[model samples]
Target: MNAEPPPPAPQWAVPPEGGWTADDLDTLPTLPPHTELIDGSPVFACPQTVFHSRAVSFFSGHLLSSAPPGLEPVARFTIDIDRSNRPEPDVVVVRANAVESLRQTRFPASNVLLAIEVVSNDSVTRDRETKPVKYARAKIPHYWRVENHDGRAVVYVFELEPATGAYTSTGIFHDRMKVSVPFPVDLDLSAIAPRPRAADPQ
Candidate 1:
């Protein structure tokens, strides 16, 4: 007789009372990697694509170089929005002194200068609609949404409106990005990703 198969893995369950807390994100061993907490619920991120990876890298690098000494650029880090929400932005510009430890995983919303989200197919709604509202409400001064358009990057810049507690579109950049707020940011968007070469004629 063939050997019996090993037992199946246990399914992960959430506490029904209030869904997932920010702390549960760190404590849950079985949770998928890059799992984000949104409105007391766990939202999982799909696998990254080449465009997403390249765009994130380009933005992080530019922010790292352009940010002032008091600010630092961090990539793929979670922000402690509140007890229920801890969304990890693709790139964040934060106060250098706000981090308590070298191993700190999350930063308070107040410490963040700018939050960036690079749009992926699976994250369009969250990045375009949901997260922007949350970030604006948290009073994050600046927000940038990067999307791949025909092998190039397009940036949608937003600034928080304090009176309304919402974000207003400051500008939209296609070929290049030049922003004065949230520190001076100037980059050639064309270099965000390596484009495919045209085929040679026979």
Candidate 2:
């Protein structure tokens, strides 16, 4: 049997008086389609490449497994950066102590320890060049950018420099990745890279 379609997303537009806020988002009966709030305006997220989706799932699964007792990994969850901007990161690692009380649909930047973005063709610049700057400004301690390189998954790790509110390049990793920042972790990059599709025959 065919599955029922999802309910329609709420009409997303700028308010006539002020702008969209986190509180306004909470009042939403149904969320909009891949919408992001930037500077009080709605910016719809681009359609993702299949590889992008795979990497998000792959990293989320591994990050969860390797997460420490008090840290939890959340995927595709919205975070309120301030009164104006709310972004949905591909994955974020947060403290359980704070998250235990989080009933709201979106948490603030203060709750996030690490943010990860899987780059797609449409979102390449946003994920790599743009978000790192924003995440750093919000004081997210760590940031990661995952992309496909020669059919292998590569990760670029960043650490926040609080003094300047900028990220310092920690490492660029491909294949086996070992690190200790938020916590110690050993990751196999190939696990996230999508396999080539099988060929059709006549």
Candidate 3:
């Protein structure tokens, strides 16, 4: 059997600074096509597509609205798992009190109660594979995948089992399914379904 091509090197192995350092990442040019440091290597994320943008906005809004008094909903924010990796998840749920502190510096992974990723055409694999492994490895408690395609929405919830470094599938909630997280609330998936727009009449 052909040797499985060596697993792609961790994104952090290459140094944009000639030497990996936080100062190098901070000082790098900040311009269009924002780059995030993952495992010390720079990963460029493209601008969100209309569908991707809408899904993120809708889900984030709902999470925020439903969150209990002590839980905070944050959107498109970076979470720094370590010096080598800082990923910006689509939506994150954290403790209400840690919001200000997380905003002031690199976002803390410890305080993140859940991390959500909305699938974009370009990033489906990275979001589904790379990020899941990374999040599981970091021992983050919950990870959610929101897929928007084929005129439908599908949400998958994975609860992490750190001992195995794997995320056990908890539940898959589709349209109309009520899904519960560890928190006190449950989400109605239909509330976030994508509605097709009417075609202009000829």
Best by lDDT: 1
lDDT of 3 by residue, 1-202 (tens): 7777777654445555644543345555542344566666677778777667777887788888888889888887777777777787889898877767533644678888899998888788878899888888777899989887575678888998867878998878776545567564555665565566799999
Task: Name the regions of candidate 1 deviating beyond 4 angstroms.
Answer: 1-11, 195-202
Model 2, 3-59: lDDT tens digits are 999976555543635788756666654556667776677666677777788889888
TM-score comparison, 1 vs 3, better candidate: 1
Query: How far out, in Å, is residue 120 in model 2?
Result: 1.9
The candidates, ranked best first by lDDT, are 1, 2, 3
Stretch of 10 with least lDDT, candidate 3: 23-32
Q: Report the Cα lDDT for residue 24, model 2.
A: 61
Ranking by TM-score: 1, 2, 3
Per-prediction backbone clash count = 0, 0, 3
Cα deviation of 183, candidate 2, in Å? 0.6
lDDT of 1 by residue, 122-148 (tens): 899999999998998889999999998
